[model samples]
Target: MTNFSHRRVKTGSDPRRLADYAALRNELAKLSHPARPDVNWQSVEKRCDALFEQNGVELQSAAWYTLARTHLAGLSGLNEGLSLLETLITHQWDALWPQPVAVRMEILCSLSQRMQQLLRTFSPSDSDYSALNLAEQQLTRLISALQRRELTPLSPLNALLSLIHHSAVRLEKSNSAAAPVVENDPEVVLTSTGISAAPSPETTRSANEVKWIYLVPPEPQLATNPQIPPPAAATLWQPFALGMLAMLVLGSVALWSWSLFQRPDPLQTPLASSLSALPSVLSPMQLETLRQQGPLSDALFTATQQQLTRLSQLPPDWATDYSRQLVKQAQLLWPEKSRQLTQQWQQQVNAAALPADTMNGWHQGMTELQTLADKLNALDEKRGRYLTVSELKSAVFSMMTHFRQTIPVEEQLRLIRQLPDDSPARQQQIEQAGQHLRAQAYALMKEKEKETTAASF
Candidate 1:
């Protein structure tokens, strides 16, 4: 290999030059460009030609010719640099081919600097970064070429392996370095196939000459962590540092995942469990307020009135033990008011007198009487288990349904205002029921759309 760090000699043939062209050439030689080992020359030439045409420059000058040649030479250096960058990307530095030790050191130093620059808003996709990498590679190759003949340094990759061997020899000097001093003995031939009956010292020595090649550590030989690199104390902590970072990131993710899996679902909590421990007893004002609550008060008032009206309609002997219990409970809740409401409803039913020839009014009054009777009957069945106002509220709320359908919006609002608000549980149940009804309606609408599509098909 020859050093290309000297100037082009000028033979004083061109006197028009202001300075010695040789001196300028010498400086230019020092400004060497790196070689790219794997760049495609055909493609580069085409690109260069296009650039020259675009730039409106003559390609006849010596400078232009040199520049073109330099550009082509840069391909090798560009390739080498790209390989390093690729190694960083893939993290397979140990797997790279043997490189000169100094070259490797220079590469590492240059890469460290380059990485710092790249870390400025480091975008892997940046075209500028790639171009800079190519430029650096070209520069490194140029320097290496200038110093190529100065005792070719050992490959950095090989040097690293040599270092390992050296370290091993240093540690186990006696056992590894001390060669066995063999006394030659007479050799005997076993067969014509070079098998010795009595081993010659030379044959044994040759047989013992082991050649070792390094391979990636096997799974069992490695620590439990797959990401961790093999321990190295002397070299830069690059591989180990990378491994530790990877392990840390993985560990954090695992911890986060475990926490998520261990966490309890909010929906799984028992329904209304928080509110179960409230005091059952209320002050007089609290009780009064509770009675005025829309749903609770409405259920109690309407259920009581209906029961009393049914009692008026039926003979005392005809009423069951269940009905009697409901009547008693209603009376305890509202004695005078229940009586008054029952009287008013009975008067309304009775006043609708129908002609003996027609059963219209009679049928209508009997229907109302039957509805009231059924409500009282249900109350009789449920009183023991149903302490909350929610149980009775539905019955009273249903009575307002017919009125709501027939009345104006203002009247409907007034009717709704009569509902009780004493029980949160009852309110939630009612809201859920309404939502279910709405969902069903939407489902039916969807079904209709599907049917329409089927018909078209």
Candidate 2:
């Protein structure tokens, strides 16, 4: 634990004051990580704002940085986070508040990553262009900043920027491919290879086994009645009967195989059908011939992506009908998952047709509680014991207030009200926070007293 109290700032540019600045930065980093049920971003954002205004040169930037990130991670206020970071990097940061160049560089890199996601989810239409432009502009700014730093082409940040740039390029290429400029038609038409593509060894073996079963007649038993000498007419008729039987069997197998191909796909059936009426639309043999596929979520994403890619290529009027049919075909094994996924796809399609930004301006802007909590825990903790006892006290109180305020009052009551009265850890933390606050508080009081005593003498 750090002695986070009683710090003086900018007093003759002292070494200790500099250290306090370092410590304050670390504390802010910890408090702003994405939330658990224990962590609430909106509440923490308020705390950082309060500290940002009151802190000295060294600590102000840290508070600003953390608060910006908190907004980015919160479910609401995605714009607020993006705008703040934009301002932070757009200006010469050191001139504004002595924020280190390295810190600004780090912010720039992180911003580029978020922008890359926007490019990935961009719809292949004009409605998507404005948001993509925002992302592209920011990414361009980041690249410019790195260039200003004279970052090498091989630097890690450069590598990340390259990946981001590629997403945008890929999206643009896809749209271009969809609207080909070529005047000439292709000489060769690409028809479905169908099941005409060569079958696997297993499929070939199964087919051969079935064919041979009918084709090969059982061997004749050695005639115990050979002495009777079978009639010539009976032997001749026996060969003809056997040949006819084999022909009948072969015709029946051929009919069944033809019917299999002609069967209507369940995906093409009307929407009123129950998912559970059949164990699967595929037959036991067909299912057996094919290997099993996917965890439902992975399958849904894959299927949806492929369909959406084609859907995007169509004109909006055509896409409207196509999207409905495409989602129907994408129904997976589970009805519930299928329903939820297709509904979401429909919503996106509807939103895309309008000028509205459907994804809250980006694909992943919303942060759920559990996800936020996990992010909070996984973040790198800043390390260092700095800040004089008084400043440390102010800093500690800010952190304490952060811990105190983020949980809802009802949750707070439930968590603490019925717990054992003896909370050693809680008591110790309070004592520590109070120690920081009071020590700094007394320092000012004592300083005032010294002036009075001097005047009286």
Candidate 3:
């Protein structure tokens, strides 16, 4: 029932725009509420499908959609909700490797919250208990990974961990009470060493009644005479049978010993061959070289870029050495303009006053930068120093476009006007910085076009 007019979709198919994202969120919200009898879940699911199918879905929006769907599915009493959450966690865990610590932290916290909510809804006897237990363990492992990576745990993360711990305790208690009894004792006796007594009169009478019925058991019997012995041939066969039995026992032992001594066939010994074929560990130098090579395949590039984007969000001192290595790789890949582009990015990041509302846009900008870096690296691998000028221009244009979208001119001007009179000169300096970046981007595009023209000739 929420108004959709204010949530207008931006031009093009980008799902990150507030309007489209808000609409999806509103739909999911309505669908997730179990008490809303008027809501049509089927239509909402179709809408979710459509939204996900849209091009260039932003990470936050994608994450939100996935989570909302998970909740909606749970509300519908479908086990698939837990399955979906588990899949998301697995994918996100792998993706965390290339993400910045802050982003990773955020992702982990969000996943933890989802898991906590799902687990809270499950009874200990439900079929989903095993999955819940696994999720709880995974959350622990994730927290440990964060610690190992030295990412400081946020308040919400700590609270989520506490909630998970409490849920685990409740689950454990319920499971223990539900456990099957392993043994049964039928009789319990009381013993007193100081006193002994004869059986009661009733017990004696009952015992006599049981004995009296069998007291007449001795009955009359008939007798028969003795019989004659077997023939001499039967006696002779007994000795022969003993001799045959001895021979059979000796033969069986001999066969058993022979079989024991036999060697196994070489071709059938698959385990031995498999063990021999196992690869040896790489040397430290080799490992270092592999690390320096960076990501080669598209999947690797995507994962690496995601992680680098997250890393870029953290304080520079946190990942100083790793950042330097990545920068070196970027410089190598885009020898002409990586430094300049990075400087412009830093200026924009520095000038922007990012409130909570604009964080999505900021993250989108970072993702675009990562995409551009990945494209450059790919191009370098394919063409070496003789890059595709058109491709480079396109990548640069895409990055700038995303950056501009993230921090629009109107927002920038508004932020500038908010600056205090004491820092009047700072506003002008920042504005000039923005102008310089725009000029640089224009010049870069022109240069790439010129390069393309020359290459064609």
| Cα-based TM-score, every candidate | 0.13, 0.24, 0.27
lDDT of 2 by residue, 163-186 (tens): 545654665666664553222111
Residue 272 CA error for candidate 1 (Å)?
A: 29
Off by over 4 Å in 2: 1-39, 51-90, 96-100, 103-129, 149-160, 163-457
Task: List, residue by residue over 243-298, the lDDT tens digit for candidate 3.
Answer: 99999999999999988888677754763553355346679999799889975578
Summing lDDT over every window of 10 consecutive residues in candidate 2, give the lowest-scoring window.
208-217
Q: Return whichever of 1 and 3 wins on lDDT.
A: 3
How far residue 243's Cα lies from its native spot in candidate 3, in Å, is 89
The candidates, ranked best first by lDDT, are 3, 2, 1
Candidate 1, residue 364: how far the Cα is off, in Å: 15
Model 2, residue 22: displacement in angstroms?
11
* Model 1: residue 405 alpha-carbon error in angstroms: 15
* Residues 165-192, model 1: lDDT tens digits: 3433443443444443332222322232
User: How do all the candidates rank in terms of TM-score, highest first?
Assistant: 3, 2, 1
- Greater TM-score among 1 and 3 belongs to 3
